[model samples]
Target: MAARIDEEITFRKLEILLAFLEAGSLARAADALGVSAVSVHRALHSLETGTRCSLFRLEGRNLQPNDAAHALADVAREVLQTMAQGIRSTREIAGYAADRIRIGSLYSLTSGTVPALIMALRLRKPDIQTELVLGSNSELLRKLRDGELDATIMGQPEGTPDIESQLLFEDEIFFAAPAGSPYAAQSAIDLAQCSDERFVSLNEGYVTHDRFRDAFRVAGFEPNVVMTTNDIFSLMNLVGGSIGCTLLPGRIRSVLPRSVCLVPLLPAFQMRQKISVSFLRTRERDPNLLSLLAACRSHAAERPLASG
Candidate 1:
């Protein structure tokens, strides 16, 4: 018997007990708790230890709560209600309960796609609050996996089995050159021709840099990467000042200055990177997750492609 019932009374364990009581079956209770049946069963044992009483009895096919459980139902309800209030109060204190939505995104997509989606989500749920966390693709994916994000907009789906991803749009990579530069007037340039030109690349950890390296391998040549920057904006500025040529999305043409020309790939080594929203597959049935997914899909359908 566990004597530290109060000490062991976690919100999750309490919720599990209450869910089992209300649902009358472990399967239904697990569904309500957003966990597997095994987890729910484990929680029941923990709950029993906390309460120091046999909560369930073995039946022919189904497990049924005993008298001790029925007696403890009132206490369980109070615990659950208190837990619910705590969540509500926390949300109120954060000011997020007032109709706000939080999102995450990769730095590359945050500039254009996120803003458009925020505005669009607002149209559907007016007065909705919005928060966007921007980071590298790996960082954003990590946050999404840890339950720290509602969903994330990033390039390429991660390899995590617990995550779910849906492609929203496609973007093509292109060559970026300063305006009025000799290369600006060209329709395209062969990778071999670019061998002698100084290149500005993303930092080694960046997915963009990895993609560029893969393309180089395909082109059968290594680039003269004289400069490296972590942010695309910095790389763009360097390219604008004629520091060096860099690879950029052709979609950026609308936002960039007319002086900078987006040259097509000569052999057209355009890589179609998928912009997607990722979330945990375990949370797929959650009401909040469902609402956010529908909102994201609806928003994606209404917004234009990353072109500009």
Candidate 2:
């Protein structure tokens, strides 16, 4: 008689368990999942606890899956396959048939790049519909990996090999301050010169937020962060209010209020964010995805070079 798997075990846990079985190691499974090894270990431990069974045996620091683990993995594979097929069939029957492309993008791009791309795509395929989701870079990448989004426009994704990306354009980062601030008069300033200045930044999980921190690291000082918010516009508003200075991409210059001044960073301290259209490589052949990718490429080619 076979042991019953825990009903509380989630599909994600099962997927992790199956990954462990196939990869034969936690680190390899984590690599495949685009997560940390600690995450894999936690999932596996949770699965074992929920099942109340020893699915793996530790042998000289390596976890070896037992027979029970193999059986569970087999079941997990079948379940996932069935779910995928069911979803595809339902969508087909509903006349959706992948006609709608769900795209994710960074909040900042929604104002210009996203709208332009959507307009161009609509012109090319009037019958198609697009759903645009805005989020931080890490959030969008996670959605893309989980199959929640067909593709995403974001800064170049790092450490995520499962995603294939095409560079759209290069955007330069600029130092932003209140219009009346002394820094506004300079043509270019080194980041170190702003070491004592209060900074307003995006919250963690944003690519720009990471880049902001990196700038501070390069400048050899910790930033005096006075505010952290999720919205780029809100951060800009704070800068305009003279709350603190910030680093922003040139693409946002059109929306900047006159109260805010954007100054160029010295060449040595300058940073550029490479915006890209990214999607799971597995969906490269889907007709709708292909169309969207083509539109993105076209739009990127037509965009003007980033100004300082």
Candidate 3:
């Protein structure tokens, strides 16, 4: 039978060996590594047993490294360096982009959510670079699933088994109308009452569009969607121009056109989206994603989020 993992020399054993050599004493090594002295002693003894070589000598009460130990230390340093380089090279070749994080997000989140996430992430990883790709929910999620993005910030995927999501915050979906539009003065709007209005919504692939269709369905009417655009800016422009009305999220309220307004939907037509840091289930433990997820949790804690 092959030797068990405990019986074989390992990377951890090599690291302990190097630590002991530099620290010069088992107690010192233990302190340096934040481990028990017994553990440091055992790792060295275990490594010596695996090699069947005399790696240490007892000089009075102190244990000192022998020729074999010094020789192995040299080899261990090179082995660790080469292995680390190889792993980094492999990750790069496979499009992992270790030094750069590729992010995809909905345009509406740019004003607040995405910027906060990236800023918080920088506190942990100052040298890391980020590339942002903005699109509708569907396009961003597709890029995430295809491995074209390292992670994405968007509405949580519904029943997506292959993806993992960590909720950052919840945002209300509201009725958007220009200031001078006929319906802008209303304190609250109900979707059912606006069936005859000309609506210009985002194109078919956005999460907001999904909510748009669902809300109208519950209201017992097909929306008179007279125009559709893929750009949130253009959609907002159309609304600001009073060309048509549409639904939008509350996160972009600060950036809404000076003449446009976001009116809350009445209780009966109210809907909310859970904005999250989403990634592939396979990348749940990726370092960059782990940092981003941490940033999401931190960001959520700082905000006076919408309550359930």
Each candidate's root-mean-square deviation in Å?
8.9, 16.4, 4.6
Q: Lowest summed lDDT over 10 consecutive residues: which window, candidate 2?
A: 91-100
lDDT (10s digit) by residue, model 3, range 108-176: 888778888999999989988999999888888899878789898988899999999988888888999
Worst 10 residues of 3 by lDDT: 91-100
TM-score against native, each model:
0.68, 0.69, 0.75
lDDT of each: 0.74, 0.86, 0.87
lDDT of 3 at 183: 74
Q: What is the lDDT of candidate 2?
A: 0.86
Q: State, as a TM-score between 0 and 1, how close model 3 is to the true structure.
A: 0.75
The positional error of residue 69 in candidate 1, measured at the CA in angstroms, is 15
Q: Put down candidate 1 lDDT per residue, 1-308, tens digits, no spaces.
A: 85444555577777788889899899999998889999988888877887777889989878798888777777878878888888887765443343555577766766567777776666666766777887777777777767577677777665678888866777778888898788877887676667888889888655677778877777778888889987887888888888888888755555676657777777646555667777778757644445566766886677555542
Q: Count residue pairs with overlapping backbones in model 1.
A: 4
- 2 versus 3: better TM-score goes to: 3
Ranking by TM-score: 3, 2, 1
lDDT of 2 by residue, 1-308 (tens): 99876765888998999888889898999999999999999898888888888888889999888898888888889999999899998764432346677899998998888888888778777888888899999899988878788889989898777889888888888999999999899999789877789999999998888878877788889999989999999999999999999999888988899999889888877888889999888777777767777888898778754543
Runs off by more than 4 Å, candidate 3:
1-81, 93-97
Q: Which residue pairs in candidate 1 have backbone atoms (N, alpha carbon, C) closer than 3 angstroms, thus clashing?
A: 99-129, 100-129, 101-129, 179-259
